[model samples]
Target: MSSARTTPGASHHEDAVGTAADGSGLLTYASLVDGKNVPSDQWVYVVDSDALLQDAFSSLTLKRKLESGRLSPEELPGGSIVGRVARADRETVLQAVEAASRATVEWNAFPLDERLDRFGALLHRRLTEQADRTIEILLREGHPLALARWQVSGALECFSPESLAFYRSQMLHESRHGERRISVRRRPDGVVCLNPPQNAPLSSALLGVTSLMAGNSLVVRAPRSAPLGVMYVLHEIVAPVLEELGAPGGTLNVVCGDPAPMLSAWLDSPLVDDIMYFGSSEAGIRFQERCVAAGKKPILELAGNDTVVVWKDADLEYAAEALTESFYGSGQLCMIPNQVLVHPDVVDRLTALLAEKAADVRGGSVRQEDVLLTPVLRNEKFFACLEDALSSGAELVCGGHAIQDDGTRDTAGIFLEPTVVLVRGLEGARKVQAVRHETFFPLLPVIAAEPAPDAVLLDRFVDFVNSNPYGLRNSVWAGDPEVVEHFVTRITQGGLLKVNDSHIGFLPGLPTHGGTGLTGGVYGEANYPVLRTSHIQGVSISDGGIRPREAVFGAWQAMRGEDGTAAAGA
Candidate 1:
């Protein structure tokens, strides 16, 4: 394992968990087949300070030398070189998949209670002990420190004892019938491949924790752009616990590299039973089809074009505060509020309030890094999106320009100023590209709804939101309980419904992802990790002589207190 050199700056230390790197500063930690971290001569590149300060997305191959072994690195555009990352090869990835496939049998047979207890303890320990390290990597990746901590800590909190207990309860079935018993069991999906989003690696990586708890072996493909946090959590936090618990070889395996080939390998491999994917709708939909063709289950957390409805009665102060998070992480998050649907009565006031809040957003600052918007690499695409919004009869409210350290207003600069735009009405807003699609920037497009003929303006608003093609999450801000309920019930599109609260934050045990239309694939399935990674089968054991039809009739009669003739008549 080799690279050019470790540039002077912050450094990452391999934890004692299970990470082992060659002396050349290249780190490798995913080929664990049966509780062992198999050493790899192939190196995954880690970007250094020189590469980051350069701001030039150099071909990662520049950092690779002939001595680095057989693996050749490729350069990708539109990402910061936090460091060049070295990753596992195709052979290693397959071995990891096969390992998980083999481990699934014993893992599924493991007692549910014991599995939950042991894994739950590991989650708590890792969160308590290594949280700071996780947060540090997130910050270095340019996430606001507070938000980074939220992502890191939230990942751990998702596996809390209460949540796991709730999931465990769902894993069992109990029924009784006149001297007979029936039980239904939840079985693991065998090998689950977790492909987390690149932007929020830590939280996305932790999404698979419940799958592991469900007794399904895991093969995680860490995002190439930011693999450290995922690797740290896996090797440092998860891998150690598996080893200590005597988990079977091949129970957990991880790999990091380019996604195209890795995805292909996973899709083609018959051993893989399920894929937990967080990615673009196009890729996810294609992958879903292939998974279906192969008889594999695909649990997708796809792109979100989230919409938020603001009723005339909404507390503007509270609504403004919650809605400003649309600009959080430069609006790069999948769950970030993408479009605002405000009643015509409150349009001007809400727009003004939102503009005021957006102006306070800090960008391109050293001391205020925690609040500053991370610089976007795809400046051209961002500008094109901005222009498209403006062309569709949208009026700029507060910010609509880029900010740079050199005062050049270069779009290439790391930060695009938090922007607010107002369109005259829903029709105009719908034509705007920013409103129609997911803008991965701090661009908020507010659309004022025209008054409905009936008194149910809120109902009309709810219908409009429900009509949204993308459905990761949709929120409504209204103080009236009836209005909130009406809106919530009518809107059947999004994976989650938020009322009078921030839309992006997730509750434990509940799904953080899932949706309809473009967001959740054809079936509109919810990507609940514990539920998605397992299947249920009914089990029945009976005393020797009872025939199948008689047993069924007896059970039905016992419950309803009717004889066979009465049951038949009913």
Candidate 2:
């Protein structure tokens, strides 16, 4: 391990720091294979998300380096650098797979209770203890503070007592019968490989830890662009817990590299039994086909075009607040509301409130506590979506421009304004691409259905929401029990359904992630990684006195009378 030094103004927990040749601080990380920090000859740097916004000199120097070919665009992600991560090669990926395959033997043998204690209970406690440091690393890696905190909170919720208990029940259950014992249990799927998405890699990686509770060894590919936080959680937090539990050295392997080779390696490797993939739905569906062809279970967490329906009876203020969640992380997150179906009666009021709230969501340096807008590296899609909606006869409610890091409007700005468009009628809304597809940007479309009887409108709203191609989450807001019930029981979409609550907030016993349809491929649903990475087996043990003939015919024989004849009813 390289020695770490604390730079001036840095927190004490910032131990990933190393001094550069000029004596300035640089955050450093390495890939972990077989419980070792494997450094590489090639390195890639991740710029602080706020570096360009906050430091003119650093920004100018980065620009000069880029122009001079001293720093290639591929080497510096997000435009400038605060940290350098080892870039793993094909060999490192193979090493990780080999280590994970070897460790799975012992890991799968450990009792489920012990695995949960180490991976669920103890890991949760350590994450809480290091919460601040974790959040700091997330911030440095470019996550807005609020989104980062929510990610950590959601990840921790997976290991809560309630969640762990639920997992335990799902994993195993035993029952007693006269002279017989019946056990239903889930067996580890052996080596499970995780390909976490780059947008929220650390939390996604942390969530992947639940596979450990199922006694499956892990090979996680940290996003090369944002590898530090993911590496910190795995090596700094998760590894220690595994060590204390006496897990094999190779139980958890992490590598940072180009995703194509790593994914191909996993798909082709015989030792890999399950692959937890996260990406766009189009690509994920194709990957799912590949995984199936390779005889590996594919657990996909894909794109979400989630919907939020607001009835006229809803508390407009609260519903509006929930709608504002669509703009969280500038709407880059998969779980946020992508489009809304509002009762025409309440559409105007709700949209007004949403625009008012969205205006408060400002773009600035990630270091700012109040900032939620991060740099939208490629906003061409955002513009294209916005234009498609408008051209399809949708009216712009508010926000259709780009904002600079300083929160000023400029075409060249890196941050997109929180945009909301009003699409009239269900049919017309479908014509808008932003409403039908995952915009993956701060572009929300509020569709106001044509006015009709309450029953007719309610049915339309439910049907519209259910017809959505992508389904990660769906939320409804209504004060009436009937309306809420109608939505709850009738809407057959999404992995989770929220009612009159924060759309993206985490709750115990509820899935922090996962979805149906495009959001999750054919095998996708509310994903509990522990359960996803394991398979169930039914076990029945009989007493020595029981004969095989008796076991097979006893139940049927009981229906017969004592005279060796069938009973009256039989």
Count of backbone clashes, every candidate in sequence = 16, 1
What would the per-residue lDDT of candidate 1 be over residues 61-146, giving only the tens digit for each residue? 54444226543333223233333334677878888998888888887777876677767767777677778777666665556676
Lowest-sum lDDT 10-residue window in model 2: 4-13
Error of model 1, residue 63, in angstroms: 4.9
Off by over 4 Å in 1: 1-30, 48-86, 364-369, 405-412, 543-549, 555-570
Q: Rate the local accuracy (lDDT) of all candidates.
A: 0.73, 0.83
Error of 2 at 149 (Å): 1.1
Judged by TM-score, which candidate is best? 2
Q: Cα miss at 469, model 1 (Å)?
A: 0.8
The digit string of per-residue lDDT tens for model 2 on 1-570 reads 334322111223345544233333566656778877787766666666667566646765774574355865455544356766667899989999999999998988888878985568888898899888888888878888888888888978878888888888899899987888999999899999999998999989988889988999999998876788887788778887888788887889888888888899999999899999999999999999999999999999999998998888899999998888888888888999988888889888998999999999987866677888877767888998889989899999999999887668999888889999999898667878998798889999999999899988878888888888888899999999977898899998889999999999998878878888898999878989988898989998986888898779887777996678998989
Q: Each model's TM-score, in the order given?
A: 0.88, 0.93
